[model samples]
Target: MARGKPDLAALETRIGRDFADKALLRWALTHVSAAAQRPDSYERLEFLGDRVLGLAVAHMLFEAFPDDSEGELSRRLAALVRKETCAEVAELWGVGPYIRLGEGEAQTGGRKKRAILGDICEAIIGAAFLDGGAAAAEAIVRAAFGPKMHEAGRSLRDAKTALQEWAQARRLAPPRYRLASRSGPDHAPSFELAVEIEGFEPAVGAGSSKRAAEQAAAAAFMAREGVTE
Candidate 1:
């Protein structure tokens, strides 16, 4: 029913590491929801991968852009290691297909879920780390998320992207930007938009257009959250 071992060899090739203990690589893609139905679970691997991934991404961020300030580096780190980004990597690696899911999770599109995919990606990294070492794990994570650090660094001023990524990672809808107050009109339109992050307080921003106001609010939110750029 699973059909030919989910082509872990392909995944291993993508990871650029040949697994001596094939079980480890397989386990990395397992999820608790799927484990409940099957016997293997990725929870432990996820735990290990979490640290492995954090360190690798952190190191890459540190070395990639030498002139970056601490705050700017931190923001880049967050952009790469964030759940949304990991999920993107997981999807790229086809980790979701190998995941064993329970009835409900599988039925409800568990494989496509960002949180679940992100967790599996982390687990896979942990598995690589355990099977090999920091270097091995770092190689894998760097391959997957390395470009993102560069892109995020370049888009530091683009707060809208930041806000969208942040909101999506939390599994919430995008932030709603509303004009809380407006002054002047026609010749000179000023807007005060309340950019509300779901489950968090709203940050107000002002700009010439609605989109500009939203971007302003997102920037304000990032600043308040101690995110640079």
Candidate 2:
């Protein structure tokens, strides 16, 4: 257990569902940093929840866009399931306050980190699935992400593309991206990338792949520059 327990009951109220097994909800909010000494953490739940989210999102897209091509649907799916989008949904549900982080992580602003919030969001979905079955998970996903899916389907561009267009419109040089660092295991490495524009300070971002990192970096730069797409 971490220092303070989260209000799981309030979380259930927000999500419009109650957990049959409250332990699942607790585990969902437990980050690996907080559960290093315990057997339970959100990692396993995140894994399961990722799959569940995928299925639900896929089905939603399939039904929502009968005329869209497979490739188009896939792009929408990718946009919807990305770490950034998950973090947005987590923030919407006020998941940050409920997350249980280790002392060091908490001190370092772990609650506001996109990765941590996104993982916990998925873990919560996984907990919902385990406690109440697929229906429970689907309901939560649909409620949380339904509007996002609709919006993405209408107009959504990848971060890199959007950033490039922003630069081009202003007649500025294309943004330059560089590898900042790499960490984690070879089996599942994390990449950090830095994006620099001619007149602005550089912004860094991290992700599981180089392209993903670049996209993240581009997104960071866009946010810093107040450029929205």
Candidate 3:
């Protein structure tokens, strides 16, 4: 880990929100492992922030994609609000260094863990909401996540769902995923899975988890089939 304290002021500038209650921001950044008491940790804030993120993203989608059907909007919302997306946003804002982890967690590189980063991102949103109410929280969410909505060729729907739908549209069996291989140690394992649809060539994809591997395989199939969702 880097020496000395992280500059919270700089983080505020990057996030575009200055906390009236500076302590709240600090609270949000405090990992459970680092807290004196679990109640003082980011868990509660993360829960509230999760809801706030959904609300803000849902509102943004409703306004920006007026022509999109409810299903489309819902798909977009899911893609944007997922933990991976939240972790990506936190990385964009350089939040890892600011996270307060216990020495054990820090030694294990907790700062860069996607799950921790994602939860901290939501905790920060929850902090913003409490510090400045709905308007402030909405503004922060929009600034952080809005541009992601228009990234070129971004898949709005879950790949697994889209692939299943694609197969159903053609009266084919639903996509089947089989674990082709597994490698790496127990602490950090890698998975390779193949997705197959009847009458179509199978596609292979890899990830750290089975579900992620399945999604990757489905997405590969969709790309090869020229499917858009």
Query: Cα RMSDs of all predictions?
Result: 12.3, 5.5, 4.2
lDDT of 2 by residue, 69-134 (tens): 988888788788876788888898888888877776776677887777888888888999999999
- After superposition, the stretches of candidate 2 with alpha carbons farther than 4 Å from their true spots are 1-6, 152-157, 160-179, 182-191, 194-212, 218-229
Best by lDDT: 3
Instruction: Write candidate 3's Cα lDDT for 144-192 as tens digits.
Output: 9999999987767778988898889989998999999998654345799
For residue 42, model 3's alpha carbon misses the true position, in angstroms, by 1.0
**lDDT of every predicted structure (CA atoms):** 0.75, 0.84, 0.89
lDDT of 3: 0.89
What's the TM-score of each model vs. the native?
A: 0.65, 0.74, 0.75
After TM-score superposition, what is the CA distance of residue 190 in candidate 1 from its true location, in Å?
39
Residue pairs that clash (backbone atoms under 3 angstroms), model 2: none
**TM-score-based ranking:** 3, 2, 1
> What TM-score would candidate 1 get against the native?
0.65
